[model samples]
Target: MKGNRHPKADIEAALKRAERAGLKVTRDQNGHRWGFVICCSCNREKLVWSTPASAGMEARRIDEFTRKHSNCA
Candidate 1:
């Protein structure tokens, strides 16, 4: 049920995981961190990208939802 990926953490972890997995990290033309283009081992692994807005909104929404549904979240 994990949604709205954590962006900054995603990049860091993606790089670490890629290196650990021996995958190559690549960047897009805009100097944006595109992370690992492909995972060399499984050939099916890919990055799950998410934005900070979505992540923050998701977290806040979940927090509010939980708070509304429970005594504490």
Candidate 2:
């Protein structure tokens, strides 16, 4: 959440990683532009987010799915 690029990508990258690891992504009843949840085998990693979370949160969320969980720091 500190670069010129959208930080939401970070979250999306995280989601992608989660999915690749056998996780699932789900949007709320509100039809996105809101937040999502990352579900693991055990439960959910719970990556709750909000738009303007750091600028372009939507795109950021998508990109975040590609990142590794450990890389989340």
Candidate 3:
């Protein structure tokens, strides 16, 4: 029941972390349950779900994405 619910603050914190890592973060146009993380240099983008279950893992995912695309033009 409660396992599927995510705390709003955790999701917000993850988005903030994404921004601090130099990624442009935007909430989905349709709702807050989804977000977009964009690479400022290459214009590459990734869709991230906003949820407490995934919040703690977002940083690592962002790091990997950045590293993989670091050489993009």
Question: Which candidate number maximizes lDDT?
Answer: 3
> Candidate 1 lDDT, tens digit per residue, 16-57?
444454454444322332323344444533333334345445
Please give the ranking of all candidate structures by TM-score, highest first, separated by commas: 3, 2, 1
Off by over 4 Å in 2: 1-7, 29-33, 38-40, 45-47, 52-73
Tens digits of per-residue lDDT for model 3, 21-56: 677776554344465778878888977765436565
The digit string of per-residue lDDT tens for model 2 on 1-73 reads 2322223565556555555655556654242334454544334345444454364554454445534342432
Cα misplacement distance, residue 64 of candidate 2 (Å) = 13
Residue 34 error, candidate 3, Å: 0.6
User: Model 3: how far is 10 from its true place, Å?
Assistant: 5.5
- Give all candidates' CA lDDT scores: 0.39, 0.47, 0.61
Instruction: Work out the TM-score per prediction.
Output: 0.35, 0.42, 0.52
Error of 3 at 37 (Å): 0.6
**Candidate 1, 51: how far from true, in Å?**
3.2
